[model samples]
Target: MIRPPALRPGSRVALVAAAGPLPPGGVERAMDRVRAFGWEPVAGRFCRGRCSGYLAGTDDERAADLDAALADPGLDAIWFLRGGYGTMRILDRIGWPALAAHPKALIGFSDNTAVHLAAQRAGVVSFHGPHPHTAEFPDFARDTFLPVLTEPRPAGVLPFPAGSAGRAEALVEGQAEGPLLGGNLSLVASTLGTPFAIQPRGAILFMEEVGEHVYRLDRLLSHLKLAGVLDAVAGIAIGAFSEVPDEGSDGRPTVRELLQDRLGGLGVPIAFGFPFGHVDDNWTLPMGVRARLDAGAGTLELLEPAVAERG
Candidate 1:
């Protein structure tokens, strides 16, 4: 993957809302965080614009904001404001060629997974981390986020979240190395059969999701398995599946059981309850970078830096 240039303290970063609109004061809060990191924060014209209820703005407007960010020569990175629900609507509309010609680190998770996949397809590495609009940026997240983007060195070993000893399990124990791929499970599953569908072959797939019912989660996993994605990966790092409910009425297995049933026999290292999702302690992950997953050790280690050294 093509790593973008490492960010400097005074680098200009553009904040754009590519999915849902930010809540009141969300943009201001994000700008403050950027300043705290010693970077200049620039907002896209339509980042705060709302239209058709949930979308940040009209599809064209939102796409334009992203395009402008990509085309700006002075901006060192583009930080997505928040990820709610509209990125898929404009995935193809954004100028991928322009972005590839002038690469910059694109950062966010959830709906921004669409953008990350698009970046991967364009041969650019992107960051899967907490959005700038997060209500509170935990210290772990900020520490992880800064170094990955600013330092031209490996991110070191990332262990499974603390307190996960009760929930973390090794389904397929062993170590596997491959480029890191995948994001929100629902977003990854949604791209099936499309040009943006995750290329999981030879990848250490990482996944997380929120608010999904257990059966629906099973169905999504089933879809991936049937599509040959499950069999193609080198290993799996399962992140948090927050708020997943047991409908109990259907007599279906719980989410954890379904996960084991679907992925246990894949013949690759599998570590569950990784700490990168819609939670307080989310860690930043570099998409498309080669990584090593050790299920026995409950650790994921990036093999290379996510950014290029400043020239």
Candidate 2:
């Protein structure tokens, strides 16, 4: 995959609402953050527009905004304003040929997974990080974003804070290194049986989800297994399953137990609860880049810089 140039102070970033519409005052909030990061913010036409209860605008508007942002040679990056559930509708309208010819960082996650798939298919690395509107957009997300997006170097160790458990836990031990891949589980599941399905051979697969019960999570994981998605990766890093029920869940195994049963046996090192997810402390992870997975030690180390310097 092609590494996008690292963002610099003078770089311009376009804010586009490619999926769900921006919430009240969301555009301004995101713009403030963008400027705070020392990058200029360029708002797309749909940045302040809205459509139905969910989408940012009509698929046409979203597609036009994305295409225009890509064609803008002056823009160094395109930060998706928010992600709801409409990115898939405009996949065909994206004008990928243009984006492929002029690659740049397209940052987001959740519904933005569709765009990340497109970037991968086009051979450009995309970021599976926080959206501007998500609470995860600031602290935890910025730690990864600031370094990689500006003064990038090989991030040798990725760490998560110790929780009430008071100590870091390791689900699987030892280390397995490979390129990072995967995103929201539901989005990944949506790609199954589709043309854009993620193919993560020799990859350290990372995934997270929110608002789903154990049964549904099991179903999605099962689909991945059935689709041979799990078998293609070298290791797995499962993040926080937010709002999920605790163990003793309707006579079924808990989310952690369910994961242990399905992903644990992939014959790969697996680690659970390493921060990044639908939460306030999500880290920015670069997709399609090599990283070392020390599952037993509770760490994922990036082996190389995620962005390249441009002359």
Candidate 3:
């Protein structure tokens, strides 16, 4: 994988909302995150100023805005404003290969998963991290966020937050190593057979979701199985499935039960609830970089730096 140059203090990070419109208070928090990392926040016009429905702008307009940022030689990184919906619509329109020519860290999750897959296809390593466009930025998120980008060395084993919220359990016992791939479950599933479809062969597959019912989660995993995505990965690390609606009285499986039913038989190392999702305590994961997943130990460790020492 082509690691972008290490994000240093004073680095200019372009802020983009390629999917959803940023809430009024969201942009300030995003700026605060940028400043917290000691990077200059360079905001795009549409991410904050305009929105056509849930989209930040029309497909063509959003593509052009993102392309302009990618072409800027002065920019050291591109952090997404938020990931609600829309990046999948403009995936083909954006220039992924050009991003390789001007490689830099691409950071965000949720709807931004489409862009992450595109970046991986272009052979550039991207960060599956929290967005700059957020109404709330928790302190726990910064524990690993700042160091992973600023330090050029391997991030080592990631630290989950304290209490029951940080607990991760092993679904299958074993250890596996490979490049990390995958993001928001629905967004990743949406790219099946597309040009930017996830190529997870020999990769550690990670997935998470939000606002989904148990059945919907089952269908998404079923989609991956049908597409042979589940069969190709070295291991699976399932992140938080936040806010899943309770299915009352039916004989339907619960979210955890559904996950175990679908994946437990795959015979690969599997761990459940390793942070990263539509939650406050998100760990910044570097996609396409080598990593180790010890399912029994419930740990995911970076094998190498996600960035370079020199540009």
Candidate 4:
């Protein structure tokens, strides 16, 4: 994968709502944070509003905004306003090859996974990081994020903040290293039979989800299992499965129970709860970088730098 240049203090970042429509006041909020981060915020034509439905605008307009950002020689990076349900719809509309000529950091996760897959195809490293919303990231997320993008050094071993039980827990015991890939479970599952499917032949798959029922999660994982995705990964790192419902009592499995049942038989390193999902303390993961997963220790370490260092 091609390492993009590190973001500097005076960098210019373009904010576009390529996925779901922005919530009211979201653009102004994000613009404030962009300035606080020391980058000039350039809003796309559709960035400030929503359309008739869930999308930020028509596919053509959204595609134009994103394509413009990728083709612009002035913007240092492209950061999404938010992640919702429209990115996958515009995959065909994106000029994927243009990214190679003007490689820059592309940020956002969840529904944004589709874009990340396309960026990976273009051989550019992209960040599975926080959005450019008005809300300030917690100290943990902010501190852990800054160095990875600005330093051009390997993020090295990610530090897990202490928790009541533990920051991370081992589900399967072993150690494996590979390029980290994967985002939201639903997005990963959606790509199973598509041209943009995740090729997990030797990747450390990281997954997280929110607000889904156990049965749906089961179906998604089952799809991966049937497709040989579960069997092919070098390791698995699970993050927060936030705010899922625990309703209905038909002997359904809880999230942890379901995970163990689905992933335990793989004989690969597996760990859960590393704080990178729909939460306040999210960790920014650079897709397509070498990372080490130590299941016994429940630790994930970056094996290589995520960006090219400027002299």
lDDT of 2 by residue, 1-311 (tens): 78889998878999999888876888888888888888898999877777887888888889999999988888889999877789888887777866667778999988888888888888888888887754335565678678876756787787564353422356667688888989899989998776677888888989989888888898999999998888898888888788886555558887778888877777888888777888777778888889988877777888888888887
Q: Quick one: how many clashes does candidate 1 have? A: 0
TM-score to native of every candidate shown: 0.96, 0.94, 0.96, 0.97
* Candidate 3: C-alpha RMSD after superposition: 1.4
> What are the clash counts of all predictions, listed in order?
0, 2, 0, 0
Clashes of 2: 2
Candidate 1: segments with Cα more than 4 A from true spot:
159-168, 247-250
Q: List per-candidate RMSD values in Å.
A: 1.6, 1.9, 1.4, 1.4
lDDT string for model 1 (80-125, tens) is 9998999999998988987788889999999999999999999999
Model 2 clash pairs?
21-55, 21-56
The alpha-carbon lDDT assigned to residue 52 of candidate 4 equals: 67
Once fitted onto the true fold, the runs of candidate 3 whose alpha carbons sit more than 4 angstroms away are 49-52, 165-167, 247-249
TM-score of 2: 0.94
Candidate 3 per-residue C-alpha lDDT over 21-138 given as tens digits, one digit per residue, 9 for 90 to 100: 8777787788887998788999886766456578887887788878888888788999998888999888888867778888889999999999999999999999999987666677
Encode model 4's per-residue lDDT on 191-256: one tens digit a residue.
778778998989999999989998899999999999999999999999989877873457787788
lDDT of each: 0.90, 0.82, 0.88, 0.88
TM-score of 1: 0.96
C-alpha RMSD in Å of predicted model 2 compared with the true structure = 1.9
